[model samples]
Target: MAQRILVIGRSPGVILDAAERLRGKGFRADATNQFDDVLTDYDTATVDVVVFGGMVPPDSKRQLRDEISKVNGHVTFVQGLAGIAGLIVAQVESVTSAAGDDTGVEYDAAERTVRLTLRQPAQVVVEAWWATSFTPPEPASTSTRVVDSRFDPGEHVVPLPAEVPAVASFVTVSVGPAVHTFTVGAMPDAVRRMASTSALPPVRAVATHTYG
Candidate 1:
């Protein structure tokens, strides 16, 4: 079976373009611009990776990340801008095993370029172990009030109720030398509210199941 991937963002053109590129590379790619649509579709499809566009609201991005981590332990989440740049390099390096080639670097910001490096399989194992051990605080049941609704782009904000519940889920993954973490709540409404606010980029949210 082909590996499944989900791409979400406000820019369908960009998302679809990336999806096509991934499909050409042999992965099964599906792209959507709506977060709710993606969430519904994820329930019915098998997804292995999620590529998010840069425009996703901060709140929604967190919820989507949480959902993806919960549904697919091994699923990789790549950011549309910075994350994509890094991921493409990583993927290329992984596939080609090309070493010490500075020719692949492409500048985005003045200080950053696409750095592709090989990832060891053992890193995945370590990540799995770390995820299993780490725990997150439960999401609040009541909606937490925010001082201001307006936020700078790319900011991550957690809007939990003042009184947080005791149940929460967290996932951790290691990509190269860095470890990334995601947190989700038991109540879907809490996550949905966050995703809907300006905090998250405008994109459809989806959750996919894996069949062993």
Candidate 2:
């Protein structure tokens, strides 16, 4: 049976677009913006995941989350960080595949290396950014490095694709939908390191608000 995904948001177009794309990915998908309708639907059918768009107010998100938790503890809730359809889809994929805790990650500021351990063959995303309270990553582009699609099951070494300024920052590795974050001290002279002479497109994953 296909996984049932419910997309809830204020925009009908965005919700429907994501729902349609999810169905194309071989999942049972539905979309709606009504808050009460979500409660009614949850009561009637088994929904594996619920994705909340940006338009939904925080109070409503909290209420819906609480109501669903009372009935079924397994239903997953994901917050749509932005209007990006792919990000929302990635959240669902990551949440569902988080069954095994069999992964390891290491980041070295001096070496400019991000080594990751995977249990299976999968596309990987390695990134580093200068995350500061004054300069939020979401609104600004303070990223020091970004790389994508270079990994196998066994442990592999990859470089942070960009140079970091002389400030403490964070590094992240994303395998499939699962993402791991690490802290690094200021390194003003860190230069970009490439895993290969060839270049590939990058895949990115951000922190998501998740609920049971």
Candidate with the greatest TM-score versus the true structure: 2
Compared with the true structure, all predictions reach lDDT values of 0.41, 0.61
lDDT of 1 at 201: 36
For all predicted structures, in order, the TM-scores are: 0.42, 0.56
Those runs of model 1 whose alpha carbons end farther than 4 Å from true positions after fitting are 82-212
lDDT of 2 by residue, 1-212 (tens): 77888887655545666777888888777776676566754441377888887556567778888888788777888876444354456567666664565677778667878877777788778666652332111222245446778567898888765465445455666776676655555323321122121342332322211211
Number of clashing pairs, model 2? Answer: 0
Candidate 1 per-residue C-alpha lDDT over 2-81 given as tens digits, one digit per residue, 9 for 90 to 100: 77767665544445555667667666666666665566556423566666654566767788888767766776676532
- Candidate number with greatest lDDT: 2
